[model samples]
Target: MSNKKPILAITMGDPAGIGPEIAVKAFSDSAVYNLCRPLLIGSAAIMSRIVKELNSRLKVNSINNVTEAGFQFGEIDVFNLEIHNPEDIKYGQISSTAGDIAFRSVVKAIELAKNGEVDGTVTNPINKKAINNAGHHFSGHTEIYAHYTNTPKYAMLLADEKLKVIHVSTHVSLRKACDLVQKERILDVVQILNEGLKKLGINSPRIGVAGLNPHAGDEGLFGDEEIKEIIPAVKEANERGFIVEGPIPPDTLYALAAGGKFDGCVAMYHDQGHIPFKLMGFVWDDDIGKMKSVKGVNITLGLPIIRTSVDHGTAFEIAGKGIASPEALLYAINYAVKLYNN
Candidate 1:
């Protein structure tokens, strides 16, 4: 029993997506094993196909239990879910079968983490439509984590080297997103963000809250959300001893945070935070018409078990191309280890 390495369960998101590819690429990097013992929880057949497709030299050691895994440095350890065949594993396609398999893998990972079978679970990307098509009815990973862990309060934290963002409402429409920003919800998210940063080793995290409307409603000209809900939330959070500042203009807050002025920012909606985070983390090469680097980790805070995932999605178009970037998955696994250590 090597106590130096934390046991991490990595789930292959959807066979139809780039999940298998990135999971293989992430573990193939020898540096990953140095931080934690990673055990992939997905189908062996799918992984085998991916290994051959990518021409990766690493071998897959299939196991039924976490303890059964070899945890070898160069070899990839997979807990075979045995859900799909190679013939059924078509890339860039959406099917209920794939959805069911992806959902089940996540469920199994959650069960293992809750039971302490693994220290944490880091997930690859999964399409919400696919998961819903399989009758799982999940909006995204955060909701799945919340349901399985029975956690009432949780926030989606997107992190990179320069900036960290926690969203108040995600996977909701822009109109509904604004409506959901009440004082209580704002305060709850703020508290979660503060606590999450502390766990990430920040002793005193300086948090900036983004406004809900354009120019923060221009002092009630654009919208009243900032004045009514956002400001009150910041005020209440401060009263509770949280080092919080906000209702700042959404467009400007992210830039300030990315510039290292603030430790993290609370985004009002999905795109408000996602765009800025991706702008900083994802690099594209226009001449090559491809992404040079895709970095960032999506962490669901307030769950009973630690859950981190790639901030990107299931790129069905490039699923089996062996070109998908594993940087995000690698970062997510590393972030999970950091959280576990903290």
Candidate 2:
């Protein structure tokens, strides 16, 4: 392991959304500089604009390449992709211009990571619709990373201080996610989740696999996915010398995982994992009409290179407001450092 600080290439997500603002906001924290040699992969003009908007002390230093980066505090070292006029991207609006910029940033980051120019990659939120509109038809960061890196099998790992959850199937509808509940898929995710947990410092992970049906199919009374698919996966996992349990009821499993009954969990689908993890991390103040704090890290497991991202989305509602919370991005940066170190 290298004693020197890890170099992290962070993609500023969507210019039309809160990506630029949040990226600048995160840079204001000096702790991130201590953790890694952070380089922002986005337009320096946009970032500079956000810095001015926030009236932050940090300045943006535009660099044509990573080698020219200063990696200094009190300034953002941006691998400036001057592809579009930053003024053209209207906040809170979906446009191909914004999408193209965001897509380019991600592609650039992946290139740098694959070439070993950076130790890992951290991402801000990107709008799926916006990216697709720009002619980039990728679903999300996980898919984008998998495709660009040539990784076939990967799982979305949502983590916080309390519970850690990995999805067996994400970015799919309820119907399709159900159809995906097969012995092979579940076992694959379990292995991914198990390895991810150990890498995150849980050597002996107690994985709780959630059932597909209510009451865990009520012992085949409700649905047979538990009996037919999930059970066999669990049996195979245990037989393979894993500390596995479940086909446990979704509701019961989450509550147990939340209270620390398990080190991590393998969720059946996206919402089954995201809902609980977000509930724990995203705190909203109803009276204030804003989030008090947004916290959670999204890690893409089974990738060739490390990729960690903020667990939230591009809050188009609050884009350019300078009010977007940096808590999640900070957590993500920390996780990126941890993953790189490990």
- Number of the top candidate by lDDT? 2
What is the C-alpha lDDT profile of model 1 across 1-342, one tens digit per residue?
234678999998988999988888888888898898899988887788789888888798888888889888768888888674447657899887788889888999999999999999999878788889889998988898899999999999999889999998999998898789899998998889988998898989999999988888899999788988999999999999998888899889988988888898999889998998998888999997778999999999988888899988898888878788888898998899889888
**lDDT value, residue 156 of candidate 2:** 94
Task: Provide the TM-score for each candidate, comma-separated.
Answer: 0.97, 0.98
Model 2's number of clashes is: 0
Q: Which stretches of candidate 1 lie over 4 Å from their true place?
A: 1-3, 84-86
Candidate 1: which pairs clash? none
RMSD of 2: 1.0
Per candidate, the number of residue pairs that clash is 0, 0
lDDT of 1: 0.88
State how far residue 79 of model 1 sits from its true place (Å): 1.0
